[model samples]
Target: MRRIMLLLILYSSKASFSYWSRQMNGIRVSGWLVSCSYSHFTTSCH
Candidate 1:
């Protein structure tokens, strides 16, 4: 019983960690793209 509970806990934690990491990666990529585009726009304007 205890082993099963431990396995469940580990599985849940791993799943949550993966989900959060994916979300963070997506945010980071979008932020990078926005920054790149903004810089390009400014340089072109000048």
Candidate 2:
């Protein structure tokens, strides 16, 4: 559980960095941003 949480945080941070960098991998960047927000909302809601 702890490992998973750590990985999620790492992945989300990397996603945010890529999104801001405006990488050409268009769809993926948007997906990451959306997923990050979704996770945040779910956790906050719970």
Question: Evaluated with lDDT, which candidate comes out highest?
Answer: 1
| Local accuracy of candidate 1 as per-residue lDDT tens digits, 2-45 | 99999999999998998999999999999988888898877752
Model 1 TM-score on a 0 to 1 scale? 0.60
**Model 2, 1-46: lDDT tens per residue?**
9999999999998989977666656767778787888988767522
TM-score versus the correct structure, for each prediction: 0.60, 0.39
| Alpha-carbon local distance difference test for all models | 0.89, 0.79
Clashing pairs in 1: none
Q: What stretches of model 2 exceed 4 Å from their correct place? A: 21-46
